[model samples]
Target chain A: MRKMTKIDIITRPGKLEELKEAMYAIGVTGMTVSQVFGCGLQKGHTEVYRGQEYAINLLPKIKIEIVVCEVPVEAVLEAAKKACRTGKIGDGKIFVYPIENAIRIRTGEEGDIAIMDPEDVEK
Target chain B: MRKMTKIDIITRPGKLEELKEAMYAIGVTGMTVSQVFGCGLQKGHTEVYRGQEYAINLLPKIKIEIVVCEVPVEAVLEAAKKACRTGKIGDGKIFVYPIENAIRIRTGEEGDIAIMDPEDVEK
Candidate 1:
């Protein structure tokens, strides 16, 4: 069984394209991206709209998920941070998880093979 | 330190509301949901538009993530499976990961407290 690590990155939605490009440049292409709402240290700020104050608890964010096997986790982490950094609060966070197994529904491929590209199968 | 577990469920987008209701009934709230694209056994299908064939390799998927400490992992897992099950291909998958710690940005609350609601603080 191959040891697989899953990285879930929650960051500003604007940084998604750059992150994608950076990951692609690093030869780590497979990923699942999603739009999410969360509250961090920045939590929610009060907004005065038409003379009324409203508190927004959940903030909009983007989440990038990448499950890697052969690729170096450190490299991916660095690339992700560099791409998403804005030097401000609510920039987002990254969570690492241990994946027990992965299966490609189409091919019924399990473990790391389910995550690799067809071209990279030879590698 | 509280023992925290993160459950990531990939299921049909339509089933999200029901799953949420089920979890809420089980006293397991606080989740992050996202729209993700993936290829499972259902992968992608060929569509013919204007007599042109287009192969879609990735399918739309909804990912629901919940991090809990006091809630029994077994109960959450069962609730999720029961709500998301359709006994069909591309129904989705569930993943469990051990969480080291969680901090609520607004209150600086850490561990399980960060995950609990303010009303539940006394409990």
Candidate 2:
């Protein structure tokens, strides 16, 4: 069984398209994208409501999850940083975790085969 | 020095409400929910497009991510299974990963403290 790593990238919503292109360029095609609310170190900006200031803790963010077995983890990280970085807070964070196994429900393919792109498999 | 685990649950969107209630009942409050697309072994279903048959490979799914330290991992799994399971194809999957660390952006809290519910901290 090959080792698999799941990379969870939470970044600015505006960077999705660029990020996708970067991932595709790196041969990382299998991904799950979603909208998420992130509450991080930024302290958030204050919003005034009827002469009162309230802190909005949760901010809208986009999360992209990709599990890789063939691509180098470093490559994915570099691509993400280059595409998503703005040298500012709210640029988001990345979390890496070890995946014990992954199974494809339709074909029952497991591990690396379960997540690989067909084009990669053909090559 | 608590161990933190991240559970990623991908399930039918209709079960979201039930899953949320289950998590709340178990004192698991902090979660990130997102809409995603899952492609698996199901082979997809056929759809007519312009009088032509097309295979829809991707299925819409709801992914909920939660990082837990104090709450028992098994409990979360059980609750999720109970809420999301339909004993049929496309029921989705659950993946568990080891979280090296977690941080709260606003207060700079790290590890378990960063993810615990305030109510849990008070107690």
Highest DockQ scorer: 2
lDDT (C-alpha) at residue A6 in model 1: 89
Candidate 1 docking classification: incorrect
Kindly list the per-residue Cα lDDT of model 1 for residues B60-118, writing each as its tens digit: 77888899888987788778777876654455656667779999898898999888887
Clashing residue pairs, candidate 1? A105-B40, A105-B41, A106-B40, A106-B41
Candidate DockQ values, in order, are: 0.14, 0.17
**Tens digits of per-residue lDDT for model 2, A14-117:** 99878877887887745777777776543656533345654754777888888888889999999999999988656789998788656543344556875665
Model 2: lDDT of residue B59? 58
lDDT of each: 0.72, 0.75
Estimate the TM-score for candidate 1.
0.55
Q: Give the TM-score of candidate 2.
A: 0.56
Interface RMSD of each: 5.8, 5.3
Where is model 1 more than 4 Å wrong at Cα?
A7-31, A35-64, A68-97, A100-123, B41-56
Q: What does candidate 1's lDDT look like per residue over A1-123, in tens digits?
A: 878898989987788778877877766736677778875432465533345654653667778888788888898999998998877665678998787655543344556776665446645
Task: Evaluate residue B68 in candidate 1 and report its C-alpha lDDT on the 0 to 100 scale.
Answer: 88
